[model samples]
Target chain A: MKRRISLFGALREADARGYIEVDVPAHSTIAELREAVQHYAREHAPAISPGLIQRSAFASGDEILHNHRSVPEQGELAILPPVSGG
Target chain B: MTEIYTAVVDIAHGPLRPAEALEFVADPRFGGIATFIGRVRQHNLGRVVTGISYDLFDALALRTFQHIGERARQEVGGPMKLYIAHAKGDLRIGDFAVVVAAATPHRDEAFRACRLAIEAVKHEAPIWKQEHYIDGHSAWSEGCSLCEEHRAEEQRAAGLAATQAGDAHGHEH
Candidate 1:
């Protein structure tokens, strides 16, 4: 039994699947509900001060701030591409 | 007979009221409604508090909430209503932090169940908080020392307010 998701938090497009499965609630939003499923690139993500995080700032500011804000908290369900660390 | 059909996620900028939680649970049999409200404070753990930033680490917040609502439906063994709302963004002093309401026929059930609901939320929910001090510093209160910056700032602010309050009373007295 699949529940019809009212609002979703997953990426618009998954690797080969494209955006589909993730569904959140209608009123329940994270950080002003600004989402860009496709443009989830590491370099594009907001930069954080490394230690003292703005906490809600990332979740509340204008989506455009994603690029402009000095720091950003990685949103939940935000797709982070594979990273390699040695 | 009512249904558990709603849940929300938002920034708590002030005190969250549970009774007002009714708009979310619009079922008639719910003669008994139990609500809980959480507030933001000037001091948390003795930290000289300025402000805080809150965020949800997991979309699981709603998922868990829905699960709770469903479980309440089952436990109540009747048509029931439930709602949970939380605030986000920059919540200032004495703002609603969160509100949860559950409707039952008996007040006892409503109160007991609502308490359990909130307890589950606090322990199981994945909410986070970060503190901002009057100084050029901030920290994650989840696991950090209380900086004097926030307390000193709070005392100073309170003193200023108290002095004003005292002056007003003095004029009347």
Candidate 2:
């Protein structure tokens, strides 16, 4: 299965791309997705700072999840870095 | 139109109107309405800011707004009307950047809900800002630190609530 991740804020800057698709085994943990994202970033967007991913937060739907949480079988995972708005 | 619990969330390209925000939450049942307006400033972090451009992830941003509205309603323990709107694209200094309005039966709940909703939108909404400076250079800001503060406060409050519940259970035993 493929999990689509949407990037925003610093993570979008890091990816240099808005959307990323990662093929994964079913019910893959968020930790795994993070690793895949890191690897993808390294390969596709070398100019982006490495530390941005370390500071990122992931959200599935309305719930922000820890690294240990399981990624749903199908949904867009939003990669959010620190936000700034009023 | 008027409604009891209005949830207005939009990421707009044109200018934002404070009157629209005020109108969204207008209701006779509420004695108080609290509003917060964020405007683009002339300077930031020592740089003479000329203007700002906002970029947002639309679908996720709207979902986050809905989430924030729901949380505010739950926090107040009843129906509450909310209006959250943000500007996208380039905006000049002194223009309204964001508006958050909340209406409840009393002043306290309205204030609390408005505060929480704005903070949540700042912390959770997938919005990015780039400030253009008078030096002919622009840079993306590091984002608001208040989000971290809000998270820590929530954690502390949850811990306190849990401890109180535990103490009550112990007393019962």
Per-candidate chain B TM: 0.68, 0.77
What residue runs in model 2 are displaced by over 4 Å at the alpha carbon? A14-17, B1-13, B144-173
Candidate 1 achieves a global lDDT of: 0.46
Q: Which lDDT tens digits does candidate 1 get at residues B1-173?
A: 43554344455424445556877765666688888777777875666777766554335556656676776667677656777766655666777767778778878778766776765565434455556776757664332111223223434655655576642111110
> In order, how many clashes per candidate?
21, 0
Please list the C-alpha lDDT of all candidates, in the order they appear: 0.46, 0.72
Best candidate, DockQ-wise?
A: 2
Model 1 quality (TM-score): 0.50
lDDT of 2 by residue, B8-85 (tens): 234353578889888888888888899999999998877799998777766667777877888888999976788888
Q: What is the TM-score of chain B in candidate 1?
A: 0.68
Model 2, residue B64: C-alpha shift (Å): 2.3
Against the true two-chain complex, what DockQ does each candidate achieve? 0.03, 0.45
Q: Model 2: DockQ against the native?
A: 0.45
- Model 1 DockQ class: incorrect
